[model samples]
Target: MDRAELVELLTPDGLTLLDSVGETDAVTDVVKAVSRLRAEGHAPSLVAAVLTQVKLRRKAVAKFGDFASRMLFTEAGLEQATRLRVAALHAGRFTAAELSSVADLGCGIGGDAMAMAAMDLAVTAVDADEVTATVASYNLAPFPSAEVRHARAEDVDTREFDALYFDPARRTAGHSNTTRLTKPEDYSPSLDVVFDRAATQPVGVKLGPGFDRSLIPENCEAQWVSVNGQVVELGLWFGALARPGVSRSALVLDGEGTHELTAPQDSDDVDVRPLGEYLYEPDGAVIRARLIGDVARGLDAGMLSPGIAYLTGDRDVTSPFVTTFRVLERLPLDERTLKRELAKRKIGALEVKKRGADIDPAVFRKKMALRGSESATLFLTRVDGKHAALLCERVR
Candidate 1:
């Protein structure tokens, strides 16, 4: 939305309309609601703005939870905003250090800023886009300690702040077409500028989990965080923000709770061992943090192949950092052989997972064409650096 639409949304009548648009209101029913509001003599622009916000707020719940009720969002801003649970952890870092304030560069929709303010840390949040900055200002209105600015992150002076939080814009122009930029140099304000700022101050740079590891400095601490089994972000902590004796870490958060494994450096190498009674799929965060060996050691397991993240052991061990499975059988990667075996086992639904293989799971699942009574997960991966498949049951 533009500045004009946002200004209109702040009007008393517009506020009343938004209040009427409940979370239970069906998104498909927006057109009917708009039609009814227009019939009631409401201006078309105001009605349109209310309808649009109703939808955006509904979508924002995944990131902001109940707080989304009072927040505003842009399509792109919401897409890039950090999840509230994750942002709270980011805020905790500053609070734990006894830092009084932080400069949140590229604070999209004020998600992180709100978290910081909730932790009682004063925040100066900045965004380059005018509309996004205005939305952030509205979202942060309840927090007197937080301020929002419309300007480039590079232009922000952080000398007054205790630390900086840099979440660089990693995508190209326009909110509609989200074309991701692959190179760090292409990022807004550039990765170089962020790195330079980080060198002199305690800073955290939030990057995509798949960011180029080669560019990360040796002295900084890199932590990969995952939620619900999906790796969300790779955070590089610099200077005083870096945890003592922790150069790499995997932080996993799920319904059960949060778990973290840290090492002074990368995990030490472990010997490759044969597949046994159980198989372990390390959490994405563990793999990204290069701590696979730590999980392998925790499970009394070993890698199935050199450079492979999968771990195998003789017993089923429980850990929050990995998903364990009982191996039913190991099969050849041959499609005809696999199809016959699956059909014989009465497997109907299959959750196809793969690594170190060139095949797409969706395409391969269709080719299996199984018709049976039970469901099972199929792992198509490399064992001993050779193509193979494993039929397994999830240990839960």
Candidate 2:
């Protein structure tokens, strides 16, 4: 069916034709219409429900079936929601008394704004897309004082807000490719512009979890947050929200095992020690924020290698920022020996982690002919400028 037909199908008269459809072709037409509607900022939940109904009856077009399958409630959707909620929760971490007015810059789908308003913070949510703005308005309907505006973050004035929250648009028009906004000027409102305007007020920015550490500004306090053992988002707090000597933090939220680690400032010169019997590796966000040292000191652990971001302690220590691993054995990075040991142990499934190793994990795993074994994590690293492997088990 053509775009016209699909659009027609979405109309009241055409929707009534659903009772007459009995073929895969009709379902395919419906899928196309649903996809178009979704692209045009239609309610995803409604579209997804309709699509599921079509799929359940096995009426969907063969080609479109695969695409429709992606719409199913799955880990991807949960992960997205979890990540957004994590970021929203971090907004609550700002040590402000009460937010009278807030600006949610680049509020995609208005999730963050909705969360803020739910916390009683009056919000002005801004997004660049009209469809997103509409969706945002609907999402934030419960918060009567929350306003959804279709505008670029840069165009929105900062003076109207007592507190500012930013979640920069990470995807472009194609939506297939994603890139981080590193340079302060790359963001819509521009980090520098936002910070300059918010220097005196509380400001928080939600950044990608994988954001480069070097890009973090010195004036801000960066926090790495993990929800359910998955590192989700990095947050930057500036101006009144900033902490003292603590420039970075790692926050892990678990019902009974919550943890928080604060990183020491760069101005503080710290000593590094050798890797002990146990090694702890902080998450990417914590390492990027240059808070590994703080985490190490917090846990009474020392750095194994300076600038390596790995913590070492002989005794068991608990910290939210670092994943503790007990080093079982260390061996030279001899592919043949490694393969032989792995094969001997019937190790098939493996989780490969690399710090500064040159070998590709995929290639190495394939070369090992790994199969028919339980789960194992292989740590590939460089020790004394030589490739080495450490067999490790989770300390928890």
Scored by TM-score, the top model is 1
**Prediction RMSDs, each to the true structure:** 1.4, 7.4
Which residue pairs in model 1 clash with each other? none
Q: Which portions of model 2 miss their true places by more than 4 Å? A: 1-84, 93-95, 174-184, 210-215, 255-257, 267-275, 298-300, 372-375
Candidates' C-alpha lDDT: 0.89, 0.64
Compared with the true structure, model 1 gives a TM-score of 0.97
Candidate 1 residue lDDT tens string, 1-396: 667887898888888888887655538776678778888898888887888888888898887889988887778888889999999999999988888989999998899999999998999999998888888998899999999999999998888889999999999865445789999999987999998998788999899999988888988999999999989999999888889999999999999999999999888857889889998999999998889888888788989878878888987788988899999999999899999999998899999999888899999999999799899999999888898999999997
Q: What is the lDDT of residue 176 in candidate 2?
A: 21
Best by the lDDT measure: 1
TM-scores for all candidates: the values are 0.97, 0.74
lDDT string, candidate 2, 253-309, tens digits: 765565666755642324665557788887665665566666666677776554555
Candidate 2, poorest ten consecutive residues by summed lDDT: 70-79
lDDT agreement of model 2 with the native: 0.64
Where is the poorest 10-residue window by lDDT in model 1? 22-31
